[model samples]
Target: MHSRKIYTNTKAIAWVTIGTALFSLIFASGKFADGSASPLQILFLRYIGGLATLLLVVLVRRERLSAYRSPKPLSHFIRAVFGASGGGALIYASANMPIVDATALGLLYVVFVIPLGVLVLKEQLSSQHFGAIAICCAGAAIVMASRGAFTEFHMAYVFPAGIAVLGAALLAVEGLMIKMLSHSDRTMTVLLYVNAFGILLMAGPAAMQWVPLSFESAISFILLGPIAVTAQYCIVQGYRLASLSIVGPVDYTWLIFAGLIGFMFFGEKPTLGVAAGSAIIAIGGIMLAIIKPPAGEHESTSSA
Candidate 1:
């Protein structure tokens, strides 16, 4: 009984950590957005920060870089390209739009993944999945339309929304790749390579549009990587102690956190429409989470 209770508690912590990390991501992105940093510059700082954290880990563990090898070099390259593209789009979107709005738009990826899985990865979608997708999309539409009432529609919204879809698709691909590679690769090895390649790919473009950083911006940029790493570690450790199903819904806490931070930091107020739409989106996401795919049905690569 004690062990079970401990396990439950750990899982709770893990979910909280995941949600908190996501919340941190919103704030970090918002900071970049408010600064009006170029998309390339934002990407550069994010990748550099992430890479530096991984390098520090490598050093502390005394792990040799050569120890990490990919069985599918081409796949890694492709994944990196897709990942970088998504990152670039996100940076652009985040910088130009409200943080909560960007996040809401990004959530549409969950809806896109449903169809992409069936078409691209040949995964079967059950009726429940379809229903969930429909519900989620409805919620997303509500959110998007709500935004239109307050602000004039711009081409920029399309960019972020499109990137969100692409990012979701890329993430789905990455998951499949990870599963295939896990046959021979350690998790850390795959992560290291992904980050390394991602950094290399973004560096040149980011440098082309670089801006001088204020002392505060420099500090924020530097801290971003370490915070992300710590948050990820906490999440991993938390999962080890708890059931995923129980912890999964807790991840939505980031939305609340994002809303709060967005309002406080940026003075972005949530209108009734935004609130109603967000609630619907949240409900759809939760439904998707709770509903299971049917037996004998292969889950799609894009479902994540």
Candidate 2:
């Protein structure tokens, strides 16, 4: 039993690392697409591609169609809205902001989840959590202030950072919604509805900017859908195989990978402030992960 536990944990760590890399790659792809497509267009193609791929997976696996049914359509729709809006905002930010900065701001989702979880899940927060929140808030402010100073207050630099913060908040809300929905819905059911509503929500803007896709763009879009869906699955699998405290921190590796990709592929670099703020934010997050919640508080529930 001890050996089995060790193996499971090792597998979880590995899967979580892979999942983080995939998520970073997804952000990179969004950055790439930004040059050739608007966020709306990317959203439409991504969801359409994801929906189609998911449907194919279901069909090929002979999964029961009924498994897609959700008891709470309205709640799922809310999730869909949050998911699509957050995704669009992140992609826009990813395109406009330095990749490392974008990735750092996105990490605020973990911090935002603290307040969101309290409000939405009625989860209790301890003094330590409040302390973490304060630190996180300071870190965010520092990052923003640093960016503004570095850019000499350029809107071109500041706007996307602001949007990235907004996206992080939206993603936190989406995470809470997912927790609620998970109580009554299957994972696939939740995902299907997210993409379904995403298609509907993004279709209008996507159509307005409609242009024929080249073969390369078409292939990229097709692959993007499955890649994102697969990353989500890998995350789920990692969490399933290990404790949240063990695996959750691994998600932050996205920032490192994003920085590497940005520098190597996009000629972007991180500033000192970016590094400091990221460190502070990461420290707070790691504390949140390591500190045990009060007993009888459903601490087993994942934060996002």
Best by TM-score: 2
What is candidate 2's local distance difference test score?
0.68
In order, candidate lDDTs are: 0.56, 0.68
Query: Which stretches of model 2 miss by more than 4 angstroms?
Result: 1-20, 89-111, 131-151, 154-168, 234-254, 269-285, 299-304
Best by lDDT: 2
Task: Locate the minimum summed-lDDT window of 10 residues in model 1.
Answer: 295-304
TM-score of each: 0.68, 0.73
The reply for model 1, stretches above 4 Å from the true place, is: 1-33, 90-108, 149-184, 229-257, 297-304
Clashes of each: 0, 0
Tens-digit per-residue lDDT, 226-296, candidate 2: 87777766665565554444454455556556656777889878778767866775675555554544556
Error of 2 at 88 (Å): 3.6
